[model samples]
Target: MIWIAIRMLTGDRQKYYGLIFGIAFSTLLITQQLTIFVNLVERGASGTYNVPNADVWVMDGVSRTTDVNYPMPSTALDRVRSVPGVEWAVPHLRASASVRSGDGDLEGVSIIGVDDATLIGLPRNMVEGSADVLSQPDSVIIDDVGVTRLFEDGRSPIGERLELNDQRAVIRGIADAVPGFTSQVTLYTKYSQALRYVPGTRNRLSFVLVGAADNVSADELARRIHEQTGLRARTRDQFARDGIEFIVRNTGIPLNFGITVGLGFIVGVAIVGLTFSLFIRDNIKQFGALKAIGVTNAKIRAMVSAQAGLVGFTGYGLGVIGTMLFIWGFSANPFFKGFYIPWQIPLVSLAAVMLILALTGWLALRNVLKTEPASVFR
Candidate 1:
């Protein structure tokens, strides 16, 4: 029965192809937009992710995210270090500075200052040169994303000189760091060097990166630091979530992507519904003939379901493949770097595809179910 139904569906190649295309197009749009959206929002946590070693982030009470932070007095580091569960605490500086590139064009860049002795705040991996290069005089490391922005002509930024706040900064290395939410160019230097590069303020410390003692969990350490110092202390994961939430609350990205996903659902329903209805209308006599034979309405329902299942499976697979190809093709683009479709996104798309098939199939089935056995004589 299912085989016969599939053959009937395939008999009309135009409608058959149209149905599949509709499902596939909708799946691709929904999945692709969702993948990009997730990746973009996740960039809000990139600063925290780049500094892989920190267990706790101690900052001023008013500071919300790594980027949207209020500077704290240098003594804040001492207060966090005094906390019992803290094994080590270092001063971390994150500030924005305008730099005069080698070409004399002024560009805004984020300055990250890692511990001078431990380099704990630098990214775990370096794309070029060694982390030890920061030991060189007037040295700073540029992130890989920054490399493309600062040197657009495919020229190497290594040894490139920039003027920041009347101080010379030599690009000594390239850090394999995640791009920030704004895809801002980031330069990492020793804490002391960053202090000189960025315009001086009364409170120079932006955050105190802390390592919890082996016996203490990050959460416990965070609570202890917060209780003792009356400062904002967040575990690494909590701080990352904070950054992500801040972006979601502040930006229109969620609403924009949501509207796009809704449109995909609507488009799928429109195309698939119209084509399926036409298919059922043209094949009315066949359905009536089957009813006249031993085939019951229950059997007829199964046949239609089999057809819908086939279309949904084929279309869903093709759409997901198309999305994967799109991501792979643009992987080299700085903006699309590190983009990945989460596991749950595909599951959500699958549910959407099934809903589309069920809705359209149910509507198209009404006429077939109501057909009288004698209607075939007409």
Candidate 2:
């Protein structure tokens, strides 16, 4: 019976192909937009992820995210270090500054100050030069993304000099760091050097990166620090989630991507509904003949389900493949770096495809079910 239903569906080349195209387009649209949306929002947490060594991040009470933090007093570092569960604490500074490139082009950049002695806050990966280069006079490491922005002419930024806050700065290394939500250029220097590059304020310590003692968990250590110092302390994972939530709350990105995904489902319904209705109308006589031969309406329902299943499966596979190819082709672009399709995204798309098929199939089946056994003779 299922084989017969499959044959009936594929027998009509035009409508059959139309149904597949509808499902594939919907799946592709939803999956691709969702993949891009997820990646963009996850960029908010890139700052925390870049500094992998930090088990806990201690900051001012009102500071919500890494990018939106208020500077804390330098004494906050010592206070956090005093916490029982803290193994070590390092002063971390993040501030915005304007830089004059070698070509005299002025660009706004984020200045990150890693610990001078241990260099604990710098990104672990270096693209071009070693992290040891920061030991040189006035040397700073540019992030990989910043290299593309600051040196757009394909020139090497390795020896490029910049004037940051009227202070001479040299780029000696390229750090393989994730670009922030704003995709701003980032330069990493020693904490002391960064103090000179960025305009000074009464409180210049943006955060304290803390390593938890082996005997304590990060969450426990964070709790102890917060209780002891009256400061906001978040475990690494918690802080990362905070950054992601901040973007969702502040930006219209969620609504925008959500609307696109909704439209894809609607489009799938429209296209598949029209095509499936036409298919059932043309096959009404066949359905009536089957009914006349003692084939029940229950059997007819199963047939229709089988047909929808085939279309949904084939279309869903094609859509996923198309999305994969799209991501692969653009992987080399700096903007799409580290973009990945989450596993859950494909399953979400598959459920959408099934819902589209089920809804359209049910509507299209109504006419077939109502067909009288005598109608075949008419």
Candidate 3:
């Protein structure tokens, strides 16, 4: 029966392929778009997630009290270091200045200052340059994606120098694809090198990055800091969560994707329903012949179900392949953060789509069964 179903669908492209193509493309677009959208929210949160070991982040009191970038008292950093479970503490200075390069002016760079030892929470997976580059008084590290500002031809070479804030600094090394939340073309510099661009201060940092031992909870560390010094602290994990919430709840991302996924769902049902109904009309003669050949109505219904399952499973496999190819292509683009399909999301989507297709087939099956075998003989 299965072999017959396969041969029938393979031979009847005029009847089946149109339906298959329509269903497959809808699935592919919805899956890829939704998958990329979710990943963007997660990737946007990455800078906050990188320092998983940090139990707390101490913020300076300025702007909104919740603003993470405002500078706190430098002495507050020492207070965090002395906390019982605290292993080490460092300050992170975030400054933004227009960086002048021979190529042009680049804006919204995240200039980070870290203590010589702790390095203000640099991610371990920096692709280019050594961690020691921050130790240099004027040296700075920039991600390869942002290196385009330094040279017209992006992949020019290593050690090409650029002028920032009218100050001379050497490119220590290149990191990969770390972007600022607001700007796409962004760069990074040393904490002290960044100070050269700040409005007034030359030595002070913006905020502090604190590290804690395995024994500490981020919440506990946060409380200890407030109790001792009355400063605000944050954890990397909490930052990731807040960042995602900020983008989705505070921005248009969630609303936009929600509309897209909703449309996809509606189109999916429409495609399956219309195509299967037409198929039932075309194959009515076949169903009638089986009923006349000593086949019970239940047996004929079973055959119709087998055929729908075959079409649905085949279309789904093709859709997933097409979606994966789309993902690979988008991952390489500089503006895109690559596509990631998590286990739970795609799994649930697949189940929902299949169930929808099944319901569509069942409706067509009802109409198909009612076509009297006697009418075909007449």
**Candidate number of the best TM-score:** 1
For candidate 3, the TM-score is: 0.87
Displacement of the residue 47 alpha carbon in candidate 3, Å: 1.5
What stretches of model 2 exceed 4 Å from their correct place?
Answer: none
Tens-digit per-residue lDDT, 1-378, candidate 2: 999999999999999999999999999999999999999999999999999999999999999998999998888888888889789999999999999997899999999999999999999999999999999999999999988888899888998899998899999999999889988999999999999988777999999999998999999999999889999999999999999999999999999999999999999999999999999999998999999999999999999999999999999999999999999999877888899999999999999999999999999999999999997887
Best by lDDT: 1
TM-scores of the models, in the order given: 0.99, 0.98, 0.87
Model 3 regions lying over 4 Å from their true place: 1-8, 60-68, 104-106, 149-152, 155-157, 180-186, 200-205
Badly placed stretches (over 4 Å) of model 1 are: none
Per-candidate RMSD, Å: 0.6, 0.9, 3.0
- Model 1 local distance difference test score: 0.95
For model 3, give the 10-residue run with minimal summed lDDT: 60-69
Provide the lDDT at 308 for model 3: 72
For model 1 the TM-score comes to 0.99
Q: Write the per-residue lDDT of candidate 1 for residues 1-378, one digit (tens) a residue.
A: 889999999998999999999999999999999999999999999999998899999999999999999999988888888889799999999999999998998889999999999999999999999999999999999999999998999999998999988999999899999999999999999999999998777999999999999999999999999899999999899999999999999999999999999999999999999999999999989989999997999999999999899899999999999999999999999999999999999999999999999999999999999999987886
lDDT leaderboard ranking: 1, 2, 3
- The lDDT of each candidate is 0.95, 0.94, 0.65
Tens digits of per-residue lDDT for model 3 on 22-46?
A: 5676677667777867777775565
